[model samples]
Target: DRSARLPPYGKKRLKTCSFTFRNALLNIKEELQKAISTMTARATHSADVAANTSKNVAEKLDLALAIDKRISKLASQAIDYSSQLSGFDSGLATQMASFQEQMSQIKRELKEGLGRLEHVTANAESAGWYFNDCTC
Candidate 1:
């Protein structure tokens, strides 16, 4: 009777081990899939942020260019008026002075904006490096 029971005991042990192994493998698979999903989502978010940042940079550059054009036109006008006036055109001179002040303000704002953009770009690059380091 003992000999007959031995076979059944060994078979039961084998079944338990196989079941445990299968469960372990399934758990590992699920964990891997979850990790992959999380990474994909993070990558997508990063790409979106990069794209939006690029768009914002383009817009800012356009604005800066427009400001430059306006400043150039105003300077040309001021130069022409100055040459035409011999101690004259006080009103035009005052207007040109105001325009010059406004242009200076715009230049300051553009510089600040470019500085901010550079800071943001640097941060993004650092973040990318961090992500790569973490992944490795």
Candidate 2:
């Protein structure tokens, strides 16, 4: 009587096991999709960062080169200015020496003229005394 009352159990158990397997597969697929999406986003972000960094480094190098060129030009200009100033100093010194020589010559001439004037005065005085003695 018990055996006749017992219901079949194999089909119902198989159905339940198949449903659990399907749910497990679905969950694994969702996790894989999420992982793929995350990896792709990270790759894109990393590429962008690398590109921007390269561009910035290139720009900075260019700026540094420009600054170096400017400094070299300025240094050359300073050297030229120093050379010109040195030439001017030498020329000025030569001119001052010439002026000093001319001044010395002028002083000598003045002294000669003074001596001549004194000699002329002595001659005039002698002539006046001779004229007075003859008139008296």
Candidate 3:
């Protein structure tokens, strides 16, 4: 949103757009095709008023379609490198969570193993005065 805050080379703002970067042009192209078909269907439309109305509608349709196309192109250019931009944050967070779980498991295992070692060490330290002095 803060395009002014961005550097000159990176003047992109991923705003809430009606059409996404990937499919806006295709959608505008489809709309233009439909408008052209509508115009052709009225080919037999005789009368000056009818022809004027059709031309006006066609011009409006073309203008709308051109605006959408331009917007789509600009957005696509801005977003082409956007795949790994903020998109990887989600995947990275998931991996970090997995790593943390693994680390916690290792810590638990170490704690258990250390508890066993301390028990053995305490028994060995006290064994010579109490047991049969057996080294086994």
Candidate 4:
């Protein structure tokens, strides 16, 4: 009855309007789908990038920890070597002092022996024990 009330030109115009509206709704739906797909792709790419960055950071952290451990070990070894060197220096100093004392004692003994030899030589010359006159 409503269609019968409309003029013949009005019915044709209504049909055209309906078709245009349907086409517009379809276009809107396609644009929404494209936007969702683009957003999903971007999200996936961002996730991959974030994962790689996290892995790199973890590897770098591990390397830093290993280096720290090595440095600590080296420091400990250096301390041990320093202690050994200190002990060696102390021992060397003590040995040098002992050697000096022994040298001093030897020097004193040599001087006393030289003096006794000089006295014996003078007594022998006064007693006429000349080397040339002795016929052995």
Candidate 5:
């Protein structure tokens, strides 16, 4: 009703202004749609990249865990070998000590036997039974 009171020129100018305003609103809407589309595409790409990175990290983590397990197994084996070597060394030392004791005993017995042989030879010589004169 109030617009009906305007002069013809004013009405024409109002129509033109309304047209321009509508065009501006349409353009703004179009720009907003383009921005939304671009943002959605970027978001999708970021999500994909994140997923790939996560997968890579998981793989590396699995490999690290496997290596850790292997290292633990190797360490355990080393400990077992070290203990076995220690036991072997102890046994060898005991055996060596026993062998040395046996050698000492043998040497003492040999000396005693030599002394008895020397005494017997002296007694035989005093009786004039010469060993070098035996032909058999």
Candidate 6:
């Protein structure tokens, strides 16, 4: 009777060990699937970042070209403005010179007229007598 009881206990121990093995295998399979999915997500994210970086670089290059063109255009405009300003300065200088010449002529005429009037006044004061600088 004791020998029959030992066989049943041995069968029970065998069944328990098989169940534990199956559960462990299932856990391992689930963990491996999760790791594969994480890796795939990371790869896709990296690809998207690289593509965006290329697009940003292209946009920057185009903007730089546009800025260069604007700078060149502004430089041309500045040169034209300087040339016009020089012409205006030259014209102003010429006009100033002409005005100075006219003013000098007016001063000379005034001095001659003043001298003539003073001589006439002196002659009338002497009753039709004329006198001038003379040497004996």
- Computed on alpha carbons, the lDDT of every model, listed in order, comes to 0.92, 0.89, 0.81, 0.94, 0.95, 0.86
lDDT of 4 by residue, 53-95 (tens): 9999999999999999999999999999999999999999999
| Tens-place lDDT digits, model 5, residues 29-125 | 9999999999999999999999999999999999999999999999999999999999999999999999999999999999999999999989889
Model 3 per-residue lDDT at 15: 44
Model 6 spans with C-alpha error above 4 angstroms:
1-37, 124-136
TM match of model 6 to true structure: 0.58
Worst 10 residues of 4 by lDDT: 127-136
- Residue-level lDDT of model 2, residues 18-66, one tens digit each, is 8988989999999999999999899999999999999999999999999
Each candidate structure's TM-score, on Cα atoms with residue i matched to residue i, is 0.55, 0.62, 0.39, 0.75, 0.73, 0.58
The sequence of per-residue lDDT tens digits that candidate 3 reaches over residues 84-110 is 666788789999999999999999999
RMSD of each: 41.9, 5.7, 36.9, 3.5, 4.0, 7.5
In order, how many clashes per candidate?
A: 0, 0, 0, 0, 0, 0
Using lDDT, rank the candidates from best to worst.
5, 4, 1, 2, 6, 3
Off by over 4 Å in 2: 1-18, 115-136
lDDT of 3: 0.81
For model 6, residues 64-110, the per-residue Cα lDDT tens digits are 99999999999999999999999999999999999999999999999
In candidate 2, how many clashes are counted? 0
What pairs collide in candidate 1? none
Q: Alpha carbon lDDT of residue 104, candidate 3?
A: 100
Q: What stretches of model 5 exceed 4 Å from their correct place?
A: 115-136
How displaced is residue 27 in candidate 1, in Å?
0.8
